[model samples]
Target: DQQVKQNSPSLSVQEGRISILNCDYTNSMFDYFLWYKKYPAEGPTFLISISSIKDKNEDGRFTVFLNKSAKHLSLHIVPSQPGDSAVYFCAASDSSGNTGKLIFGQGTTLQVKP
Candidate 1:
């Protein structure tokens, strides 16, 4: 019973194309959503995030969209570069505390071809 799920295990795209990654959550109490990118041996680096209060949030080439009612969220990366190839993780956390615990989805491996 994973609360967070990334049904797609992997995604591939051309260097200059858009890469769309999808996620779903079963927990309705979650109000914060985040997307993180991880390289081989390093910890995941935060990319973009969206709160339940907003439908979308964008940062440079990355954007995150959240649909609270459907319990779905997606991250879009425009003009993905070869350097962008990495494993992406979707995470959810309740706003109820500063404990900093997060429920994460199975990561999606993104391959950006040069």
Candidate 2:
């Protein structure tokens, strides 16, 4: 089973607060992890990523941490803004080859109130 799972369907936070999203995976073969953010009708845009060899990766306002032993990963957004309200999807792929196939979690919708 190569399923990536986002246990929570939504999260709410006040502006300037911290927002955290969680995800889990069943496939140990997945070596690369990515988080994507999506607005209304648009496709998901890549936010951050980390390899299995690394425990964490951070972007400007986003950070992703991976726990290989637990088969879990999480995304953290500091100083969350109203513009961060959107659906976030966690994806995984096997880096062994160039298949370009990504397994995505159901998604977590985050709402930031100003």
Best by lDDT: 2
TM-scores of the models, in the given order? 0.96, 0.96
- Residue 9 lDDT, candidate 2, scale 0-100: 97
lDDT of 1 by residue, 1-114 (tens): 999999999999999999999999999989999999999999999888898999999999999999888999999999899999999999999888776789999999999999
* Model 2 segments more than 4 A misplaced: none
Q: What is the per-residue lDDT of model 2 for residues 1-114, given as tens digits with 9 covering 90 to 100?
A: 539999999999999999999999999999999999999999999899999999999889899999999999999999899999999999999978889899999999999999
Could you give me the TM-score of model 1 versus the true structure? 0.96
* CA RMSD (A), model 2: 1.0
- What are the Cα lDDT values of the candidates? 0.94, 0.96
